[model samples]
Target: MRRDEFRKAFFDASDRVHTYAVWMIRNREDARDIAQEAFLRLWQRCETVATQSARAWLLRTVHRLCVDRIRQRTRRQEVSLSMLPIDSFVDADATTDWSPDGDLRGDVIRAVVALSPEDRAVVVLREVMGMSYGDMGEVLAQPVSTVKVRLHRARKRLRCRLEPLCEKRSVR
Candidate 1:
């Protein structure tokens, strides 16, 4: 791709790529690094990657980078919520239908963070980022059917985990 085309692609997809990284790993600094690395990789391969597919390419790259980061965190035995600031768990502009109540929001964030990385990625991509199953499948390297199943299972798991909290709030 030419410089102007690359610039347009970067401007168009950079925020979405960064947001995906943040939601995947729940660490702003690491997310920024991951976004930068993904963009750098895109730049390296700009000759091959089409401008129309740049966002998807960036997302796929970000997903792999996040998986690697998560694996490294696991290997180091340092995957703890306390390692990141409370605010980093959920973005302020995220489309998650979180209530204004901080406690409930915290509970919801905890439930999401507790999910396995794959499940969390599906949830963020579908629910938060509003990507279609086909797009998600491309980013995740899964079949559309598999993406649907994963998303369904992830939502069910989240509902099961948060049901009690909702019930408690309703009872009060």
Candidate 2:
């Protein structure tokens, strides 16, 4: 594609790409950086990336970058418990809907965060990105059957982890 057309495609896909990155990373600044890097890679290969598949390519690129980032962080010494940032739900902020009252939502977020990176990515792609199994398989470079199995296992684990919260809500 021409430079102008490539730029237009990048701009058009930016918002969803950023949102997906943010959901995967859960940090605004890091997400922005990841999205920018993905776009840069796309720009470098603009000739090869078909317009129709741009979104899928971008999504997959961002997902790979996130996985790499997590792996790099893991290789480094992890943050100590004492060094971890405080949960700010102490007072309502637009950042999260998780209040003391919405403990279930908070718990679910924790569970998701605790999940393995691949499992978490599959769950986010399916649930948050609303991608079909075939689309997810394309983005993830896995078979459709593998994508379905990963999504099913992820959902089952999430549901099992959140079951107590559901029961508590029902009791209330």
Candidate 3:
């Protein structure tokens, strides 16, 4: 494809790419950086990557970059980005339907943050990104059957973790 075509495609895909990166990495600045690099790589490999599979290629690139960033941070002993402060949702300027519920939403966010990276990524791709099993498999580099199993296990694990919290709220 030509430069103009590549730029258009990049712009078209950039928003979702950034969102996925943010969901996976949990830091706005880092997510932006990762998305930038992913797009750069996409440009670098544009001729190599098939036009029909560019979205999957872009997402897979972003995912790989996120994993690398996590590892680099780990080696440096930096706190995990996924471990955000509970007050992250306590904004007075924000409006959420769960605002009346106080800490329940925060608690759920915490539970999700506590999940393993792979589980978290699977959950985000399936639930947050609303990706199909085949699409998810393409991005995750797993078989469709493996993607289904992983997503199933991730959902079950999340449900198990969230159930007690829900029950407590219900009891109140």
Candidate 4:
């Protein structure tokens, strides 16, 4: 990409790239790193990257980078709340049980974090980022059908995971 084109792409995509990274990684600092690295890679591969497709390309690169960092976090024993076993995270310290009386947003966030990273990625990309399935497929390197299926499954899992909490609220 020419410098001018690259500049335009950067200006248009920097916030989106960072938002996607933050959702994937759940750490602003790390998200910034991923955004920077992805942009750097884009710059290095500018000759091959099409300016018209730069946003999708940047998002895909950031996703892969986030996955790699997650792997490293596992090795270093700093796995995210999202990677924790649902049961383990829910029952940590055994100090309390989840109830509607507790903060609903916190409970929802905890449930979301307990999902598999892949599921979380689809959810964030499609739902949080409001990307169409085709766009999500491009960024995630999945076929459109696969993206649809994964998103459906993730929603089902989240609904099932949160059902009890919802039930508690309704009962009250």
Best candidate (score: lDDT): 1
Residue 73 shift from truth in candidate 4, angstroms: 1.3
What Cα-based lDDT does every candidate model obtain? 0.87, 0.78, 0.81, 0.83
Write candidate 4's Cα lDDT for 48-158 as tens digits: 988889999999999999999988998899945443322432334654555434656556767676778799999888766899999999999999999999999999999
Steric clash pairs (candidate 4): 1-46, 82-113
Model 3 spans > 4 angstroms off: 80-96, 100-105
Sorted on TM-score, highest at the top, how do the candidates line up?
Answer: 1, 3, 2, 4
Write down the TM-score of every candidate: 0.87, 0.81, 0.85, 0.81
Off by over 4 Å in 2: 80-107
C-alpha RMSD in Å of predicted model 1 compared with the true structure? 2.8
Residue-wise lDDT of candidate 2 within 1-172, one digit each (tens)? 5556877888888987887776666566778899999999998998898888999999999999988877776799655242112252123554465665466666766667667778888987877678899999989999999998998898888888789877987898
* Lowest summed lDDT window (length 10), candidate 1: 80-89
Alpha-carbon shift of residue 135 in model 4 (angstroms)? 1.1
Off by over 4 Å in 1: 80-103
State the lDDT at 12 in candidate 3: 81
Task: Tally clashes: model 4.
Answer: 2
User: Which of the predicted structures, 1 or 2, would earn the higher TM-score when compared with the native?
Assistant: 1
Q: By lDDT, highest first, what's the ranking?
A: 1, 4, 3, 2
- Top TM-score hit: 1
